[model samples]
Target: MTNAIQKLYPSTKMSIVLAVILFTLMMPGYISQYSVFPIFIIIAFISGVGTKFLSAFIKSIFVLVLFIFVFQCFLIPSDTVIWSKGILTLYKEGLEASLLMTSKIIAISSSLIWFFLVTPIKDMMFALEKAGFSKKFTFVIYSTIQLIPQMKKLSQTILEAQKSRGIETEGSLMIRLKAFLPMLGPLVLSSIQQTEEKVLALEARAFSATVRKSSYYQMSKKPVDYLVISVIFIGFMIFVWWRFFK
Candidate 1:
């Protein structure tokens, strides 16, 4: 996380921002098609205007969209509305497939951005507490979220180390997959070792104490939280009304 980001979100605020961003992004999937394009444009604007994490999320969106296009063009059931160009016919059924896939692609992209960048991991856990989660469960959830990025980087390091040691299985496609075994085993072992160390450290600190703990940056739902949440709820209702009842 950038220092700027850290300073901006003292933990709780980041989580609420992330949650709202995700909710707004998913609005397209839950409503009629009339709102889809407009929401898409808004999300695109968000991504485009962002200086950080924008390109990565955009690249992910493109990858998903391109895969969807391939699947729709080649795998969907054929129909009579095929565009016949000499020997090739592009089926109309593919259009529906493409739209569905596009929806999924955009939704997933938005979610990744909101959760990974817009929200800090600490803030996410804090928000979970506000949502009535038990402290123990929230601790575990927060730990896991923090662990993932570390784990990914560790896995990459392990893979590179194994590759450097001439652990080459590059000939056959199956052999290439089997090569992952070397990396996976070491990574899992490393994770276990790290977990054991963490457990001991937690135990030393009396982490399992029954006494309640107070938060320095306490997460209380302010008037803004309620006001923001209410606007979202009402917007959702109105969206549904316009979609189904209009």
Candidate 2:
């Protein structure tokens, strides 16, 4: 059976993540915001995408978060010094600011990353189309979302082709650099060539036809999906009231 989260409509998943992000942004104190990260990890595990989610998080956002933390701690102006050396010093206010900023960053990034990890792009596009988005608009959204993965796949194929031809892709750092340099030209040319071919294919298939298109894949928001979204919305409103009015 498919994972429960993977079965939910894309919009439902999106609403859940968006709620978490808004919560992280509005909630004061480092403990509250930072706590969202682990909660995301737990949700990822339950959703059966723990490994992929964590891998993407570590590869993409971990270093940036660390850099921001260190940078803010040392560079941001503050009156209270927490630690100091001749030329390097840490400020109390800076540390506090860094913690807050880093927590929000982690929370927001993890939410986005988790959402994408669990929701397929094809499903998202289908949902958008079903929601009355024009073909061209949905295609633009689809292409933008698929760009990075497509580029990575194309580059890997080119690298493999080079390797088959005895290119020295694996060696000392400089040798690998040399190998990568040769692939850049082919990669760019191939990408442009593919784009042209894709355009022609789309034209032949009447991609811009006025008739409504049908997709083989079908998705709908079930009762559980609506229930989850409602709960999230109510909780969000409650939090907003508690934060602002109460």
Best by lDDT: 2
- Model 2 stretches with alpha carbons more than 4 Å out: 141-182
lDDT of 1 by residue, 22-54 (tens): 454545543333344345345435544354445
| lDDT of each residue in 1-246, candidate 2, tens digit only | 299988899999999888988888778897988888999999999999999999999999899988987888898778999889987999898888889888988999889999988898888899899989888898888888779898888888888899999999788999999997789998888778888989989989998687998889898899999999999999999999999999
Deviation from truth (RMSD, Å), model 1: 5.2
Q: Which ten residues in a row have the lowest lDDT in candidate 2?
A: 69-78
**Which pairs clash (backbone N, Cα, C closer than 3 Å) in model 1?**
none
Q: How close is candidate 2 to the true structure, as a TM-score?
A: 0.84
Provide the clashing-pair count of each candidate structure: 0, 0
The candidate that wins on TM-score is 2
